[model samples]
Target: MSQSRRNFLKAMGAASLTAVGAKNAKATPKNVLSDDRFGVLVDTTVCIGCRQCEYACKVEHDLPAGNIDDYSDRSVFEHMRRPDHTALTVVNGYPSEKDKQQQVTVKVQCMHCDHPACVSACIVGAISKQENGAVIWDESRCIGCRYCMVACPFQIPAFEYHKAIEPKIMKCDLCYETRTSKGQPPACVEACPTEALIFGKRYELIQIAHERIRKNPDRYYDHVFGEHEVGGTSWLYLGSQDFSKLGFPDLGTKPAPGATEPIQHAIFKFFVPPVALYALLGGIMWLGKQNREEEE
Candidate 1:
């Protein structure tokens, strides 16, 4: 091979390695879970299906929260709803297994995993898990890759596909910026008329959840939903029936990243994939052909 060809190959190899290293470093999460980090305990038994928390979340985030009274219309509860770009947190009603006449209300939002998969999936480091147990997104840094949306076990992160410009990935940030940072509970927790949502240190919340289950063995399902799911989450839940019956996914105790990170790291460590390598070599060969043609 020509000296120029050797130099080109060396440069391409170095570039590929550097790119892989940069991506791996950027994808790694910087934040560590703190012992003092806060969490919310959602007691579904105490919830009234009033949808007050839903209204509060919208109002706090300055979303298109129509009249507060509009949330009282129970017709919306007939169909299941997930949090989207407009609403970061939503209250969903499910029929009680024991009594079809009675309804169980569950509020859903970002679980804010102790080991957040979204943080590990964001190539630009746009998504981060804060020390206070809030998983937040930085719109300025986000390239709208939607990797976080795919990584999240709860399917919480939402994309603004409708917007043509400056679209956002939206999810509940635990009211970190507006409420928790100032030593206030999240708007949803505060607005819960039945006081079903309790906010406190994560560890404390877990203890409270278990204690509630212990005292009212018949009332609770004897399981704290988020205590061990996806290596624990900041949003713990207490339910009358199994969490799955209330729309919660049956995730394993292992962190979501634990299942995929090793494979990703191995691939990146090996430099470019086969397809990328072929594309790079093809480009190099085409460039060399052009150079030889110019000389002729």
Candidate 2:
């Protein structure tokens, strides 16, 4: 083989080794969720589809503060909407069998998982789970790769696709900087007229949720939506109908990252896969060189 071919082969081998080393590297210390962590209980049955929470979230986040009256427009409920870069939280209306004419509005935002997959997927340490149970993203540290979007089970993280430069990963932080850190309720909870959203310590909230379910057995589903989903989320939900009707995924009691992490770690640590990948690429390059030489 020519000297250039030898050098190319050596480069590919080195790259394969480097890739394996990077993938097999030790992860950062896991951020454990405290029992005293703050959380919110969203009682969907009581929610009037007012969209006051959406307006409150926007105002608190310093996003577009449109006329508050405009939020009352129920036409927006025609389609299911996800939290985008422009809006951190959105209240979606789901049909209720109990109420034929009216739909139950459920607020959608970051679940702030106890074992956050976004934190694990973020190679740049952009995302973090706060002790208060808020999952926040640091724009300065974010590489805008959108891995967090893929990692999040709820698909909470949204990228700023419109911005040409320095776009941000946007999601709910549970108003940690504005209110939760100061022991005040989030803007949505505070602004809720119907007391649909209750904020307190996560353990306390879970107890309250169970009590409510027990008291009004006919009013709510027996299970709290986030209590054990994805190893428990900071935000819990209660609805009369099944959560699947409210667009919530049936994620089961197991944590999302638990099933995937081991497989991902082994793929890189074993080295066989990366070596084979590089070998295939190198072979293709060699074939291209041969074809070019024949033409010459």
Best by lDDT: 2
Q: How do the residues 48-148 of candidate 1 rate in per-residue lDDT, one tens digit apiece? A: 88988888899899899899888888887889999999999888889898688989988999999999999989989898888788888898899999999
lDDT of 1: 0.90
User: Could you tell me the TM-score of candidate 1?
Assistant: 0.84
Write down the TM-score for model 2. 0.81
Looking at model 1, residue 61 earns an lDDT score of 92
Instruction: Provide the overall lDDT of each model, using Cα atoms, as 2-decimal numbers.
Output: 0.90, 0.91
TM-score (all chains, Cα) for each model: 0.84, 0.81
Model 1 root mean square deviation, Cα atoms: 6.3
Which lDDT value does model 2 have at 105?
90
Model 1: per-residue Cα lDDT at residue 65: 89
Tell me the spans in candidate 2 whose CA falls farther than 4 Å from its real position. 1-31, 267-296
Clashes of each: 0, 0
